[model samples]
Target: MSVTPRTHVRTTALVLPAVLAAALGACSSFDQGTRGIADALTLYRPEVVQGNFVSKEQVAALQPGMTRLQVRDILGTPLVTSVFHQNRWDYIFTMKRQGVEPQRYRLTAYFEGDTLARFDGDDMPSEAEFVQRISRERKVKVPPLQATEDQLAKFPVTPGAEPASSDKGAAPSGAQPALSYPPLEPAR
Candidate 1:
C-alpha cells in the first residue's frame, strides 16, 4: 500500500512538471518569435533600385525648327509606327525596378517638310507595365511563318510546267459543248 502511494506521488510529480513544461513551451515559442521579429527589424535594410530612364524636361527643350538628324541626336528612334505615315513618329524611353525613382520618356512626332512640326512626350513605364497595358488593348495572336510548300517544292514554276488558272472557271480539256451557256448577269 505504501509503495503504491509513493509510486502514485512520483508519477503525479513527474506528470505535473511535464504539464507545466508543455504549457510554458507555447509561451516560449511566442517569445522566440517576437525576438526573431525584433532582430529582423533591427538587421533589415532597404535597397536602392535603378533603371534606364529619361525625363520630358530634357525633350521639351527640342524645338519645332529642329531637323531630323538633330532630333535623332536629342532623342532615340521611334518605338511604334505605321508605314503609311512616315511623317508621324513616336519616341519612347523606359525604366524598370521598384523602390527607385522612375525614369521614362516618350514623344509622338508629326513632321512637316524636313522640320519637326510638333512632338508630345510622357514618361515611359517599365517592360512589365508596357506588357500589362498592351494586354488590355487586345492584340491578335500570329505565329511566325514556317517555309511554305512553294519554297519546299522541287518542281519549277515555269509556264509550261504549271498551268495558268483563269479568273473564270473554265472547263477542263474536252470536246466543246454543243449548246452555248446561258448569258452572264448584267451590271447593276
Candidate 2:
C-alpha cells in the first residue's frame, strides 16, 4: 500500500467543517419533533392598554383648524356619528376589560361654515377653552381628569401617536411625551 501523505490528511480535515456548515444551513426540513425549537425561538404577544375617558364632556369642545386626523389622535376613532355632516365626528372606546365596570364613550363635533367649531355628547374636555365653557354644575363625564402615574405608565399617549412601524420586533420601552399636532398627510 502507498504511504498516505500527512499534508493530504490535514487538507481533508480543513474542508470537513466547511462542508458540514453548508449542508446544515441548506437543510430546511428536519425529521424529528424539533420543529417546536424554531417556534420557541420566536414568540410574541401584544399588550393591550385601555384608556379612561368619561363621556359627555370632552366630546363637545372641538374647534376649527382641527382636522379629522387630529381628533383620531386624541380620543381615538369614533364608533358612529352623523353621516350627513362630514365635520361631525364621533369616537367611542370600551372601558371594561373582562367584566370590570363596562366603560362607554360618545362624542359629537359640530361645525360652522364647514369648519368644526363646537361639539357635545360625551367625554370630558381636556382643552382649556372647552374647560372654561363647561359648567361644573352639570355632571361632566371626562377621562381620569389628569393622567396618573399608572395611566401614564400604560398606554401612555406619545406625541403624534408616533408613526406606525412596519419593521418587526421594535417597541418603545419607556414613557414618552404625547405627540403634538401632526400635519395631515396629502391624500395619495
Candidate 3:
C-alpha cells in the first residue's frame, strides 16, 4: 500500500517516542546506579521527631524505688505504655533528619508496685550531644546578640520628646518638657 503524507507523519510520531524512550533507557544505564533525576531534584523530607527524647542526663536521674510520678517528672512522659504490661513504661525516640542518619532509641522502665524496679535501654546521648547530633553543620555566621552602637544610634532615644515646630527658632508650640524615664536595666 502506498503511504500518504498523513500516514508517514503518524508513523514518525509513533516511532519518535519509542526511539526517545530507548535513548533515555540507555542513558539511565550510564548513571552508575546513582539516582540521576532524584539526586538532581531534591525532595523535601521534613525533620520528623517522634516519641519522647530521653536524654542520658534524664535517664541518669532515674533511680530504683523512685515513684512513677518522680519518673514522669524526670523523663517527661512515656511514649508507649501497654495495658497488658502495666508495670512497664517505654520511652521511644526517633529522629529523622534530612542529611544525618536516622536515630532510634528505646528506654524501658520497669516498675514494682508503685516504685521503679529497674530500667534499661540503648545508650542515650546527653542533651548537648543530642543537640549536636540533630543540628546541621551550616556555615552561617550568626550576628551578635548585642546590637552595635551604630544600630542603637539610628533610633536616637529622646524620652517624651515632642515633634519639632516648623517655624525657625520658635519654642515648640504647646510642647511640654521632656519627661525622664527609669534606666532600662536595673542597677547591678
Candidate 4:
C-alpha cells in the first residue's frame, strides 16, 4: 500500500491531456452542429423575373408581312436589337422562382425593310400555362371567412340601431341608415 508523488504526477499528466482533448473535440462538434442548423434554415431567395414576356397567343398573331409598328404593337418592345442587325429583333424572357424549375423563352423577328418578314423562336407558353408554371403550390390554411354567432356577439350594437334580426332580408344590427350623396358631377 504505497502512493508515490511521481506516480500521481504521471497519472495527472496523461488524464489531463485526455480530458482536454475530449473537451476540445466536443466544442468542435458542437460548432459543426450549429453550422448544420444554420444551413438547414435557408434564407429567402427572391424570384427574379427578367426581360419582356411574349406569349404563344402573341406569337400566333404575328404575320409574315406585318409592319414593324404592328409587330411592336403586338409583342411590345424587343428586348435585344443591335445596330449591326437593324432588321432583327430578339425577345427573351427568363423567370427564376423558388421551389420551381427556371423558365426561359426566346423569340426572334426578322424584318425586310419596315415590314416583318418572319418570326421564330422557342415555343412560348400561353398566358395561363405560363401563370401555372411560375406559380408555387402551397397548402395554405385559409381561416373560415364567416364568423360564428359567438364572435358576432363580441361587438356592441350601435345606439339608435335595432338589434340584429334573424330575417334574411334585414340589414345587420349595427349598420347605419344609408345617406344620399350629391352626384359626383351636377346632374347632366
Choose 1 or 3, whichever is better by TM-score: 3
Q: What ranking of all candidate models by TM-score puts the best one first?
A: 4, 3, 1, 2
Q: Write the per-residue lDDT of candidate 4 for residues 1-188, one digit (tens) a residue.
A: 89899999999999999999999999999999899888889779988879999999999999999999999999999999999999999999999987779888999999999999998899999987777766677535658799889998999688877655679776676667679867898876
Model 3 gets an lDDT of: 0.89
**Lowest-sum lDDT 10-residue window in model 2:** 45-54
- Per-prediction TM-score to the true structure, in the order listed: 0.33, 0.29, 0.56, 0.56
lDDT of 2 by residue, 1-188 (tens): 66579877887899999999888766744524567886666555322324434334344434555766666565566656566856666554444333245545555666554446766655444545334333335655667668769877897667867656686656654656667866699656
> Residues 40-121, candidate 3, lDDT per residue (tens digit)?
8889988888999998999889899999999999998888999999999999989999877988999999999999999999
The model with the greatest lDDT is: 4
Instruction: Mark the regions of model 1 whose C-alpha exceeds 4 Å error after superposition.
Output: 1-53, 99-105, 123-188
What digit string (tens of lDDT, one per residue) describes model 1 on residues 73-132?
766555666798888877655544343465555568788877989887675454445554
How far does residue 108 in candidate 3 sit from its true spot (Å)? 0.5
> Alpha-carbon error at 186 in model 3, in Å?
29
lDDT of 3 at 78: 86
Q: Rate the local accuracy (lDDT) of all candidates.
A: 0.65, 0.57, 0.89, 0.90
- Position 106, candidate 2: lDDT: 57
Off by over 4 Å in 3: 1-35, 137-188
